[model samples]
Target: MTSAYAAVYKEWRDDPELFWRKAAKAIDWIKAPQKIFDAGAGVYGLWFPDAVCNACANAVDRHVEAGRGDQAAIIYDSPVTGTKRTLTYAQLQEEVGTLAAVLRKHGVEKGDRVIIYMAMIPEAVIGMLACARIGAIHSVVFGGFAAQELAKRIDDCAPKLVLAASCGVEPNRVVHYKPLLDEAIELAARKPAAVLMLRRPQEPATPTQGRDFDWTAEVEAARAQGLFADCVPVAATDPLYILYTSGTTGAPKGVVRDTGGYLVALEWTMSNVYDVKPGEVFWAASDVGWVVGHSYIVYGPLIHGATTIIYEGKPVGTPDPGAFWRVIEEHGVASLFTAPTALRAIKKEDPAGTWLQRYDVSRLRALFLAGERADPDTIQWAEKILNVPVVDHWWQTETGWAIAANPLGLGMAPVKYGSPTFPMPGYDLSVVDDLGHDAGRNEMGTILLRLPLPPGNLVALWNQEARMRAGYLDDFPGFYKTGDGGYVDDDGYVFVMGRIDDVINVAGHRLSTGGMEEVIASHPDVAECAVIGMNDAIKGEQPCGFIVLKAGTSGTHERIEKELVQLVRDKVGPVAAFKTAIVVDRLPKTRSGKILRGAMKKIADHDPWTTPATIDDPAVLDDIADALKAKGI
Candidate 1:
């Protein structure tokens, strides 16, 4: 009954260097490093420092060289635009080469930073690979990001060029990105030298002659001239990309990922965690702007020579609740990965599972959930309805890939309800107390990882090495503090409750809001829920729950609220102080689908808080505030 992960874990723990070295061989490195890992320099450990390789070569050219040129490398499905296209490996290589030549012709050089602000299209992937081909670093901002936010990233990275599309087609609207890009450049302190605009045929925008140029024309001209950018060799530790993470407070921090280690680690995850084989269609429903898209959607699958699906549509919209199922069926997707929030939306929109049953998902091998903690209710519901093994894994933007998963590639472990199973081969994780000491089994504490972090993990904050060290390493000296509160059970299964700061102090006891949320979400009528600590003069802090009900379900607000309160009280006890509940039409969330608990807390506390640029709907905050006031809280 033992899982294959047990044997793999034993092998990994016995000699970590040998394990990683074997993993590194999956890619075709131009010059392999003699050393496996070097931690002598600083808190930011270096892996394969002496190796020289091109990320583009490993992801694109190598497969074509191996005679897999005719295989589909990417399938672009944009339900918003009613478009579907596939690019073979050879075609993608040529397109990437042409774009790289265009970048070089625009004076982009090795080691220069390029800003990519494009939609979730094949062109975005081309831009990323083109930068990698020329050894130029790329910083991709989410297409939906506000001009102010994009300007901030531009100022920080000081990219030589900005690559953007004219517009993005969403379910309900067409977002004009050209105007936003222009505004961001105007607001930026250090503007890029030039802007390459990808013009969509559906929504045309005029490009300025000198400062801006059409990306399509440049690529076509380069291809006609038989010009292509040659892949450049770069030291293993050379900067690959800088991705800025939008924090709940203050300025965003740019996470720097290196070239060599990222490729090796991601290649390993393809076979080890995702269990993906070459030519298999792997769909990660995420924007290319986020880390999941960078690691899973773009690089990981390509490095493994698997076909990746770049979807430009919402989980529920872009037609209906059947959109995802339709995509899976059409693409013959083998492995599917997405966020828990998306699953919640899908479950809400199609409560009876009628839409999901209409499509054939037999080709799907696994469904992975991340970005946020997957509640037990949603996981079980998805598994039951889809008839697939639904797994919940945990990681962060800092860590490019999954740190803990069920390891479906090895073998399926018995599902542990809300737990993400075990830590991966290279990650050393533990639940620690306030004193930085390991907590006992089943004890909730801060999650930490014993350094040095595995390859593919961030090396340092972009131009903020001191901040990186102080934020992660200095907290516990030897361990990288995750800033999340959770526990490891006796079986070694990890339960990520939520962010440590989200823990509420009720009277003298501390209660995790995520735990309360899980209970509330377990209710049949509840589709999704967010729990926050509201300031209370008597109890110090009380748990206030906001819930979104399932479609076609009808009940009095008072009755539903009472049921949720009773569920929390019964599950977490009276110490949780979960009395108040509000039914909301929608929860304020970031574009990435993370619940804006901080904003919810501010509204519940009756404090003033500004709408973040990352929020999908800023007015939802006002609605929540109004609902709170209407409840006389």
Candidate 2:
């Protein structure tokens, strides 16, 4: 079986270009483009040679054609309500196909944008796939985003149809999405044609300005009306989805991903990095707004015919630590993928208590962690608690593909904590020096990919020609600059320090704020830590740490601060010492659980909080800032 799996991988890897060409032959092609090799002009690559295709075909239709229609397509779980739904590949096809007809009947056609405001629900999945199936481009704003945030996306996309949920229960609270959309529509100059609403918890919410159409009624009407929507075969390079990333500077750019290139990259990465197995359960815990959700949650796993889990609600919902375990138990999830933030909390909550004891995780063979760097402590915590080897991989949205992965089915056991371990096949990782030269052994430099083009990375951001050019091409010139600082160790494992700006320069000595957080988290008194640099009269910049202590760990400023400072020094050398360590009850975090270091840094520097668009607890920043100020800056 091992050799057979490898043989399959090798046969495809050896001629992936050929394999993709063949695999795509199954998709219905429209007018084919005439240029597959226009990439020499820098950041402008034409793909699919003018062939027309639907994203849903590769994700669903083809899987059915391969006789895997009985296989599970999606296993959806609601952690807050403890409800579950499973759709088979055939069932998915019918649902998406039916919905595509309804969308077409409603005047959502090719080139039209559809705004999806929803959480992780079957309707949301069906809506996105249905749009892809019928050639309407989708833009999914995160469900946690407020009306102001959703209005920006809606105005930008200018969608013809808005697919939204009435309301949904999150970990701790009920979100009223219909009211938000209604508010946004009321604020809009040109409202969308209609808002198709899902009845979450079957609660009948107030209608949206006479434009609200009940989804259940509409879907049923479409089936009853016997309307079969015609498929509009889009050019392979046609836009599939427009994802917005909060720019480091300026307004959010609509990052457009088209049919062929995007899906090809996603399918390639899923099969290669994760070793996707047909009929096996694959769970990617990301909000649909994120690129991870777009690719893995909707595209990659579905295309592979793997059963993907769409989990709604937070990891720790209400007052239970076993929310995740219950989902795994309910679904019998085989492959689990999540972030280290959730892992850290789970480990902290149940140090020696086996939460996995609650589930039949026998089906769970491989566990992967990404999104951000999972520190050595998180890795060890997972190992001690979960009893499953937590494989850490690294990538970015710009790269499109996972550059570094601990590839499945390969048995090499050099576990370098906090490292991606090795360069994945078909990619090369180099730490280039400031002088545009490669670094020496164990020396840090700007991470650059030796690139003509990798399979998974985008050629450029859509529509913004110069924006794409400046973001990727102009920076490193010939190399894809990753904007990260890392070094390949003597053992050839790549150790990522953090983002270049995330490094603290204290008296001209480069120190990673991430490194300090790792050491601080290891202390028994600490639950989490966020580190940043602040200006000082003398040292130019000083390390300032904001940390949340473990429950009941005496919150006195003098005692906790001294203990943490000494703990870091003892654990990771005096080089890791902070100028001041602050103890707080909470840290500002995104709804996705990423600590808002950007917001914290803004507060520390007296700058505006530009990126805290959907903060879970915005008031946490105030408490943290107050605590930090009490320590005399």
Candidate 3:
């Protein structure tokens, strides 16, 4: 059968300019682009080179103008605060307009940078849209980020204003954001002119008299005066947002996303990749601070006129292991996207699949996983337990949208155990060897994309054009190096092994830690695991596995460790050098649930390493260090 995705892929590849032009029509642009793509403009490919439009108009106002005013735009579900709020397109427009006016009154103008340091509340989305409405570039720092990290972003971007909340409600405790914001303000070299504070009613906080202004007061006053900021027409290449991503060197790189092309790419993904129809409920369980939330939860769904759920709850905490299932049941979510780490946690909490039977997940047409590599064991477990096709897709902070996915919206592809399906329509992905030559099928190599890159890709690093070129472009000449090691099978299904740096060289043999972790996780006793390469005397590097056992699993540490070692040997090979496996109570992870593999690698190597600011729990690092010292590795 000629699948819907195949047809679109063929059309897009056949004539990319015509394909993108037709796709761009889905958006309501003030000035339609004369040219679809301009690849001759340096390394950063330009999309809609001559177009002028407002991202806020396409995301919110267009739906209201087209008589979809009553349609739900955002559904705020915060289990921690026991709050539920739904904003229709009309209501959202009013809120965004009022806030936009407040921003203008505060001296924020076009091309100004605004730093948003708020919790996962409706105001966060409002702030982003408001910035877009007034043509200000927004950079949202995760609410849990430390003051030092926030201060770094402030200094780098030199934002004109800082939008923050008093506190964020979590299941265990309340996180005070105001104190951190105040500290960051003091620490920042280039301070913002004003800090707008949103008060959470549950935990009321008073704002500073001179520096901080109450968001509610400002918005209400603007509303009373009947003042609203008009959408500013910006060039297609105008930056929409600057999101900072961590590099291997520990310094963060600010990835710049443009306005016009981002909208077109996300809108297309909402329907084609997510299989979501207009007005259908879609939920991407991620924070607005990350790229996943920026693309799927906020922009993609909204641009497609779909109801997006902004969930402020953990997969386990906010209630129980069934929180995600309950959300799908309550909201009739047609598409549910989340990280593989989250699913692994859920599975660990309820290994018997008890949560699956409690909720009626029939409304869920598909379950998507991203943010990291999805192991075959987890995918199989999720599929069997949920009885839904568990689609694992691949993307990056630089891409802004899915690069490879199953495309269930077009036609359901047969689920491959570890592969993230085929490359999306607009991307030309290939695996390259060390010399930048194309590698054979099924042979692992660095992933590269033939330039010019597709729309929605990062245009340049904020204030670091040379760094952007050196980091991504210079490595492979004409190709954009993805810095990921993976291979495509004969059937053209790409299976991402892991980051290229994560590949371990053991005695002249290369082994992927991801592949080894997958084998270890397949063990019944193991809940989750991370593998890192440690320096050795004879062998170049030795693989060390850190295992987190499933709840109530019975086994001695020594016995289970030996079993895991043998399991890796049997599955991967004898040359894998999977010598040691240590059972730990918990694995270090970020607030977003990504394992701190780099930190673990440092610990394994017995090198001095500082705990990352984004780590969810610092105690885990101590545990890892103690374990490594005891083993005398």
Identify the candidate with maximal TM-score. Answer: 1
Candidate 1's residue-wise lDDT over 606-630, tens digit each?
Answer: 7887888789889999899899999
Error of 3 at 183 (Å): 1.5
Per-residue CA lDDT of candidate 2, range 500-529, in tens?
Answer: 878777777778887888888777777677
Candidate 3 lDDT by residue in tens digits, 296-368: 8888898899999999999987799999999999999998999999998888888888977998989998899
Error of 2 at 50 (Å): 3.9
> lDDT for each of the candidates?
0.91, 0.74, 0.90
Residue 352, model 2: lDDT of 55
Best of the two (1, 2) by lDDT:
1
Error of 2 at 419 (Å): 0.3
The TM-scores, one per candidate, come to 0.99, 0.91, 0.98
**TM-score attained by model 1:** 0.99
The candidate 3 region of ten consecutive residues with least summed lDDT is 244-253
As for TM-score, the candidate ahead, 2 or 3, is: 3
Following a full C-alpha superposition, what root-mean-square deviation does model 1 have from the true structure? 1.1
